[model samples]
Target chain A: MRTAAAIAALSALLAVFPFLATAPWVMTIALFTLMYAALASAWNLVGGYAGYPSLGHAAFFGLGAYTEALWFNHHGIGAGLTPFAVLPLVGLAVAAAGLPVAWIAMRTRADVFAIVTITLLFVAQTLAYNLRGITHGAQGVAMPVPDFAPATFERPFYYAMLALLVLALLLSHAVLRSRLGLALLAIRADEDKARGVGVPVGTAKLGAFALSVGITGMAGGVWAYYLSFIYPQFAVDPLVTVAMVLMVFLGGRGTLWGPVLGAFIVAPAQQYLAYQYGASQLYLLGYAALLVLVMLVLPRGVLPTLGDRYRSRQRRARTLRADVGTGVSADTGGDIAADVAGEQP
Target chain B: MSAPLLEVRGLARRFGGVAALDDCSLTVRRSTVTGLIGPNGSGKTTLFNVVTGYLRADAGQILLEGRRVARPDPARLYRRGLCRTFQQPRVFADLSVLENLLIASGRRRAALAGPRVRADDRDRAEALLAEFSLAGLADDPAEELSYGQRKLLEFAALLMSSPSLVLLDEPTAGVNPTMVRTMERHIRARHAAGTAFLVVEHDMNLVMRLCDPVVVMAGGRVIAQGPPGDVQADPLVLDAYLGG
Candidate 1:
């Protein structure tokens, strides 16, 4: 009930923020934040939980964007809200495409898996550059501008992206709480042991990979439709995958809200830095500095650290209770003091 | 007494020029605690790995319940009711102890759908935790456990699967006496309940006390196999232990 209330309040705040902001740039930043939050959460499913750092998500993202772009172009959905309708199907198609890739990539592990996925990004970028007939080469695909008034232009996209974020969050929560979640967590700890214990390691990981990329593709479709124009450069950027990874690492990996918090923190800083120093590309300097800072300070990331501390305190209390039952002495005045202090809510 | 639960026939596995397991044949009868004891470099661990499907055998066949297993994928073998614990206990360190138990599959046969943890699984996990004296740490992550505790946790997890043949690798090697006692009690209890165990331990005392039809390996081959008293008195066994 408490979680439900928190979620309801957060949703309400997100839904109402655009109306009050009014500025075009603010709404743009807001939309991008939501998009990154959703993308990072999706990435967390496989990368964080299964301990598979999939750098190939950028390719899936590009495919989703291009699929939507090509669909809109072919159907001639002229600058209207109709492109939003097929986002789910776009997600499914890209997820299906992800299976064969997962089948191959998941065979190797750790650095090898990363290597395979990195190859995917380059291969995808090369294809996008060379596939002139479908992707229109490097010229880019342009969507007809939406016919909405300037006052209400970003609202639809913002709301759409918010819905995607909510969907991603809910899915992350569900997966974490289920048996698949247990399997993924086990795989993350020790893949060999996970298999030895009958985890169905391959199938569980594949399912997570598919779900992760599927959600990412949906986000890409929405992002493409919102941006109104996408070239290979921006659509399939490897840096995009890095950004999501950074968000997850910054907030906390494998925790539900970590990616969301990381995305919320990162996307705005990125947008603001780009807005300020994008021409010089000096914003990258700040990003690199921030990356170092994150590593130095929160190596395990935020949620896990805080969670460990909280659970440690809980463990202490429970152990104390068990000790009391076993007729063990408190040992010290400080120990009793600390126990009482920790026991308080 | 009954049929052989696990039969590894003339199994040979090599690494480069070294043959870790050379024509090692062994049979673990149903409902028996069969100990595989040898020196540090003996092929006991290698044989365990090969039979449990962690490593492929160079030549030979393994039959579980009369059906020959061609490919020994660990998960597949586990669903076929074979489970193994490592020398260094491999508990899910990040998960709660209860979760560690819950994560191990409880079914002997493969299910069409995912085997989500059932209510009975929870009940059994709790019962096992109390039995193992780990009830106080059920909500704690396994990483917080002591080395002996981790070994106990690993044994509890293997028990969760209701394994037909459990291959235990040095289950009580470094554990304290109390923990070792708890482990032996559980092993005996489980064996009495009709589960078979193939244990690899360095402790001669434990092997003699707990195992019947003990199999001793030396230089990657089974040099001796018989009842505990018979194997203990064998000249080859004496040579393997004291000379080689």
Candidate 2:
């Protein structure tokens, strides 16, 4: 109930944020915040729940951006419902591209899986650079400008990204409660045991990969249109994947709201650094150092740490409530039945 | 009663130069708590792994209810009603105890459960928890439970699927005496309900008490077999335990 209420409150805040911030810079920051939040939520599905650290998610994001760009330019669909309509197609096509990659990467465990998945990012980067005719090489591609007034141009894209985040959160929540979620969680806990217990580990991993990258690709499409342009470097940047991973790590892994919270915390700091430093590399170094320091302090991440504190407080209360004599060690968080080894017949 | 519930014929598995299972053959008759016992280096665990589809045999035939299973795949075998436990009690430590039972609702691929947790599953998990006397810990994470409780949780988890044959590896090892009795009682109750168990345990007393027609293995082959009294008296069984 508490989690549901929190999600509802945060969602309402994001939904109403546009009207409160009329300044372009504020809206731009909000847009980036929503975009990264959506991206982080998408990454959480695979990395957080399934415990598959995919370093190549940027490849899918870049693919989505390029797909949306190509579709927009080819059809001359300038800032309309049709462009928004193509996002699903963009998501599916990129998700299909992720299938073979998932099939290969899911075969390995932990570090090897990371190594295999990171390779996809580099490959996609190479393709984007070398595909001169299709990607326009280093020159980058341009998105059709929206016909909406300049003052109001960012609203639609902002709402689009917001909608994407909500859907991604919904999907993540749905998976978390389902048997599919249970299987993924079991696989994350112990893969061999997961298989022995009748979890279809292979299928669960693949399905999650598809769903995660599919959302990421759609986010990429919205980002491309919002920016009205995309170069290979920005589209296929490794830092994008790093940011998503870090956000999830900061908030909490395998948690629904953790990534969103991380995004709200990290994206603004990142945008601020870019705003103040103006391309100076010092802040980037500082950013990395600060993030590492935070993670080292909160190894389990923010949400879980808070949950632990809450549980400890709960335990303290339980301890205080225990009466005189007839001593009951209610310490195992009220799981007293587990203490009944000799008591059972 | 004459028909074999499970049969492993001439199964051979090798780890480099060591043959873990050398022409191993055994039959678990219907409705029997069949015991597989051996010394440490013998093939008790190896046979259990191969038969449960955790490891592939070099050459063998595995027949469950008179039908041949081609290859070793744990999920597929589990759907065929062959559930197995480990030498150590391995539960999903982070999941709730009730969830550990709910996650094993897999007579088929559990991924096919789609996007919703069925209400019936929750009811079944509650019922199983109550039956195991773990209803109080249903909301607690499995990690918080003691080792003995974890073994009980694992046992209850496998029961959720209502498997015909449960291949247990060292179920009583490292557990307390009271917990051991509790496990024995549960196994007997389940056996009475028509479930067969293939228990790989090192406790001779447990084997003597729980199993019928115990099969003894030495150096990767069946050395002696019969009722516990006869097997205990067999010179070959005595020699394998004492000499090897």
Candidate 3:
């Protein structure tokens, strides 16, 4: 109920924002924020919930963007087709690419798996970079804007992107609530134990990897259409991969809203930093340092930290009630409860 | 009665100069509890690992229901109705209690399908949790459970596989007396329901209580195989535990 209420409030706020009343730039920022939030949320399904940190998510995103770009350039396919219609094919391609990597990498453990995924990003980047004739290589593929009038142009794309983001968020929510999500969590907690209990550990991981890649791909495709241009650099950029990871970790990995919050917070800040500082922007570096600090201090991420605070306060309140009943000093009881609750999850 | 559910003949495993398992042979019948007891470095776990396909045997053939099996991987063994618990409880700590059980069920709908768990699987999972007294903590993170509760959750997770044979490696270790008794009851009840168990336990009390036919090993060799009382009387078994 609380989650639904929060979602409702957020949606209502997003529906109006500064844009519905006036400002165009605010609306543009909102659209970009929402899109990145959706991407980060999709990445979280496998990366956060399953505890499989993926550096190769950008590979999926790039694939989707390129696919949509090529289709638009050749077939004249426009935004008229629902995002859902385009999503299935984009998802399929991403999953297909992800399946083999998942199968191979699932055998490796810990840092080895992380290294393998990082290597995959390098391989994908090289392919995208060298593909030349088909991909337009480093030069990038330019997508002509739909022939619609200027005023109507950006608004339709904004709403379309918003709808896609909402769909991605809802899909991620459903997955987290389902059994596969639980299985992935189990695999994360202890792969051996999960296996003992009959988790086809490899298969479960593969499923998550494929799904994550697919959703990321769809988001990428939407992003490409929104921007009307994409390149190899955009697909394989280390910043794209790092940003996804940072967003999830910063927002509070495993929490539903963590990645979305991360995206909204980080993306706009990055854009602003790029605007203000140009190529010399140290915003991302500073953000990385903050993330490290957060991990060192809180470890469980922001949501869990906030949740811990809320729980401690509730415990203090309860203890105060008990103190009243026993005629003990409220201060002492509250202090004790606060101390104990500080250790509680 | 009926033919043994699992038959291992001449199982041998060597790690360079070390003979982890040496020509070990065992038979486990359906609806019975079998204990595999040995001291540290006695290769009891090695034998279990070999049987469950976690480790390959240098020389041996494993037969399940009279079908000759080669080196079976963990997934294959699971599909063939063999499930195993590790010496260390490997529960997914971040997942909820119910989610752990659902994952353990291992009901694969299709290879490329999006999400495979059916509604009935969930119903069955909940029922399994209730049976193991874990239903109350269904939504709790698995890591938050007590040591005993985690063991019970591990058992619940195993039950989801619906295996004919379960390999429990020290299920009673680190559990309290009360929880041990609960575990004993749970094991006995599951045995009665036609699930074969090969239990590797250090606890003699649990071995004596649950396992009828006890097989004792020393230095990777089957030193004795008989009733628990008879095996307990064996000089080799005694020496293995006491140090010669």
**DockQ category of candidate 1:** acceptable
Please write out the lDDT profile of model 1 over residues A33-68, one tens digit for every residue.
Answer: 999999999999988999999898999999999999
User: Which parts of model 1 are misplaced by more than 4 Å?
Assistant: A309-345, B1-3, B107-117
Residues B32-150, model 3: lDDT tens digits: 79999998888989988888887888998899878877667776678668988878776777777887776766665352144545677789988988898888899888889998898
Report the error of model 2 at residue A264, Å: 0.3
Off by over 4 Å in 3: A21-25, A76-88, A151-153, A326-331, A334-345, B110-139, B160-162, B238-244
- Specify the poorest-scoring 10-residue window by lDDT in model 1 chain A: A330-339
Best by lDDT: 1
DockQ for all models, in order?
Answer: 0.46, 0.52, 0.45
Residue B165 miss distance in model 3 (angstroms): 2.6
Q: What C-alpha lDDT values do all the predictions have? A: 0.88, 0.87, 0.79
Evaluated at residue A45, the lDDT of candidate 3 is 77
Clashes per prediction?
0, 0, 1
In the range B75-98, model 1's lDDT, one tens digit per residue, is 888878999999999899999999
Query: What is the lDDT for A340 in model 2?
Result: 37
